[model samples]
Target: MAIFTIDDVEKTFKSGDVSEKILKGVDLALNEGEITALVGPSGSGKSTILTIAAGLQKATGGQVLFEGKDMTQMSQEEIRKIRSSEFGFVFQSSHLVPFLTVEDQLLLMLDVAETKLNKKQQKQEVSKVLDLVGMSHRKDAYPSSLSGGEKQRVAIARAIIHQPKMLFADEPTASLDSKRSKEVMEIIRNLTKTLKITTLMVTHDEEMLPYADRIVMMKDGLIE
Candidate 1:
């Protein structure tokens, strides 16, 4: 079965009497262990698709299936459980806790979201992920002390710490310089391959297309 399947999904926002249709009859799928890039111009419904798939928002009409289980009908609590245990997210900003150390940020995620790893196992698991993202040495440092690239690396480490089956990244490199952006992309691609993590990233950078196994383009409310 596919890791994720979106079948004829639609989303519309109601503003008083008129409704704005954002996504119109969309269908998409993701296989295990592959990196897919969702590319598009602004207002192309890229983030909307990701948010719906992540269960952050309900589709107006249609189904979202993960491992063949429909999330559309699941309770909010159930969907939150699924998101915490099975998926990870990275955004344009690192979004690390200002007061927590890098290690603490990662450990907190495993504590609240994942159940498969115990305290000892969690530490070991997080260690390996930090190393994979080349943030091992800075694990003890606080977010305020790290550079932009370092903070991003730590964010990536935290996202994968629990070993989520799927990852969603939206404009992950939007805040980095050209050189730093390239480095971050390389690390993401390598780590995704090593862990066999299925990833869908929405990005505007055409230079990073070669790293993705497949590029899916969206325009307005449809995939083009």
Candidate 2:
């Protein structure tokens, strides 16, 4: 079933009487428990649609429906509430805090999501997520001490620790080498399957397309 739907989405940026249209009537849908890969060259607006669907940005024209509720109609505070509780994100960079331990990172995500877990339960959840990402041994290590793959693992752990219904990944493996990229993609696929999390991923790497259940190609600001 379709869990999220984008209907004729359009985005325009205006500066000094000049307007650029990034998205021109793009439409797509993301199914439940499936990974949808958005692929395109630069300037194709792949990332723009991803961010708009994820509520990180707004569409100038369209209906973004999540679970049948129109996100485009929601206020900033309402959208923020949904983002904190229902959506998880992975970016090109791990974006981990340099000072926080690996376990502490997941714990912080739980807090930000307002998961309502007690202190002890929160710790246990952290341990479980770390194990899932194969970072259990590095739970006490800070980001600076970890390798690139390890940091991305922790970032994935932190993302899913809140049990979000949707995962938005933007060039998640762009910073890693081929081996590490495949490893990270495998982890993301496995976790998304096991947890039944619907994922919308934007990636330019052709090598990673096989990992996604569906591939959407974009060109000239439209699905092609």
Candidate 3:
């Protein structure tokens, strides 16, 4: 089943008297337990579409349906709640707290999501996710001390710490070297499949395509 659907989605930006349409009535769906890669050139609106679907920005028109609910119609507070509880994000940068240890990062995510787990349970959950991402050995290390690949692993662990139903990744491997990028992609693929989380990722790297179950190409603001 499709866990997320984007129908006739549009986005536009205006500056002074000039206006630009970034997304023009694009449509796509992300199925359960699969990774869908959105690939396009610099101006193709792939990242715009990902952000819109993640509720980070509002679409100019059309529906973003998650589990049969229209995200576009949700109030700001409603969307915020969903973003915290149901959606996970991994950006090109790891974006980890400079001072927080690897283990603390996942704990922070659970706190932000207001997860129901008690203190002890939360720690166990964090450990489990860290193990899943193969970063458990570095749980006590700070982000500053981690390698590029290790930091990305920690970031992925934090993103899934709460078991979100959907994961949105924007150029997740852009900063890493080719080998690290492959490792990161492999982790994402294995976790999404094992945890049955639907994933929509925006990436310009053609090397990442093989890891995705399906690839959606966009051009000139529309899927092509």
Clashes of each: 0, 0, 0
1-224: candidate 3 lDDT, tens digit per residue: 89899999999999999999999999998899999999999999999999999999999999999999999999999999999999999999999999999999999999999999999999999989998888889999999999989999998988888889999999999999999999999999999899898999999999999999999999999999
TM-score of 3: 0.98
lDDT-wise, the better of 1 and 2 is: 2
Model 1, 1-224: lDDT tens digits are 37999899999999999999999988999989888899999988999998899888999999999998999999999999988888888899999999998889999999878577778987887788888888889888999999999999888887777778999998999999988988988988988898888998899999888889989999987988
Error of 1 at 51 (Å): 0.8
Cα shift from native, residue 121, model 1 (Å) = 2.3
Better of 1 and 2 by TM-score: 2
lDDT of 2: 0.95
- The deviation in Å at residue 111 for candidate 3 is 1.3
Q: Model 3 segments beyond 4 Å from truth? A: none
Error of 3 at 194 (Å): 0.5
Q: List candidate 2 stretches off by more than 4 Å.
A: none
Least well predicted 10-residue stretch by lDDT in candidate 2: 150-159
Model 1 — which ten-residue stretch has the worst lDDT?
111-120
Q: How many backbone clashes does candidate 2 have?
A: 0
